[model samples]
Target: MKMNPLKVIKNGVITENPILVQCIGLCPALATSTSAVNGMGMGIAAAAVLVGSNVVISAIRKFVPDEIRIPIFIVLIAGFVTVTQFLISGFFPELDKSLGIFIPLIVVNCVILARAEAFAFKNGALDSLFDGIGTGLGFTIALTALGAARELLGNGTIFDIKLTPAGFQPGLLAILPPGGFIALGIFMGAFRKYQERKAARQGKPEPVHAAGCAGCAMSGQCGAAAKGGGN
Candidate 1:
């Protein structure tokens, strides 16, 4: 199928952002986003795996047995994640230490596996590649913003660069686990409101593609629920 490249890109980044819209990969988003640098590192590392797995899976979709498709996808994602882990450890030791288990944990990251199964398994190679990139970028952008917000409020700095005045007291909660959830909740709410306003302006409901949710890790559950609803 000939998919519009621009639309594919826009869909991942805006229409259905992996983090903001689908709410996948919150583990890393919450855990690693204590600072902008940490968040960016995690994002790029995952993006590398996401793009590679998507391309390889799409290329071999026809040959992979339906029964073993999930296993094969996991292996492919693991390979990419391993490679990414090595590159980060070798060149960016500080970030490697900061991310720690999360780096290796990317192998099971829902965002990567979900895209491989739902998108690459069904789409052409080129489109799948773009989808991976777009999704990766969206994921990266979301983490960066989240991290920046937390860092600024928690540490009175962003990317380790001081911005707040000397007397400014940093919010301890901003850097804690509770803060991540709070920040994410606020972001999700704002995103939904923006979509709603945009739809209203256009005089139509915002378009939601099931394919977007299909790429979510909870797709199986979602599908089952949808079927039950239809019955």
Candidate 2:
């Protein structure tokens, strides 16, 4: 396929990170990323499934009926995820136990399905393979970073090795569920800032996000509801 592999990978990791930029698959990302190993393990496992499913879906796209394509895509994804789970369990018992049910849950992750629908089906198998590789790396980078941060802050360690001074008190909350949101928020803010700086350095205009509910980060804090009620 006529594709720039590095560019595609860069887009996935920096521009369209599944967790950091797209904000998809947060539940699994947050739940299993309490430590670096868990995060890395989950990321790699999900990436493998994503890559396999994307390539297979792209290869078989021609025959899939329009109405049932979603089901077919999901089935393909589930098959890949099942294999990935088994491989993980056999090779990385600690990771399998640490990640728990989240590994199987990869079947439903929006990132994988979104890629299947948006990129794989429309692209050639070779392109889809690279796309999968790129996006998977993005998923891995985001999770690993988040997990590392949480691990370091919460336990004063990374990959189970001490990195902090003896006097440092581990920030217990950093490993909790709330820590995920807080750490993610900080990462998002930093990512945006990095994008802004990169744009400035490149002498390009700052990217502006679409305004209003379609792109709003508030989820559903809509003033429109109250305005409609009043009217």
Candidate of highest TM-score: 1
**Candidate 2 residue 137 C-alpha distance from true site, Å:** 0.6
C-alpha lDDT (0 to 100) for residue 182 of candidate 1: 95
Per-model CA lDDT versus the true structure: 0.89, 0.85
Q: Residue 147 lDDT in model 1?
A: 95
Residue 230 of candidate 2: its Cα lDDT?
57
Find the 10 residues in a row with the least total lDDT in model 2. 210-219
Name the Cα RMSD for model 2: 4.1
Runs off by more than 4 Å, candidate 1: 206-215, 222-231
Q: What local lDDT score does residue 34 receive in model 1, on the 0 to 100 scale?
A: 91
lDDT of 1 by residue, 186-214 (tens): 98888888888899999997755334356
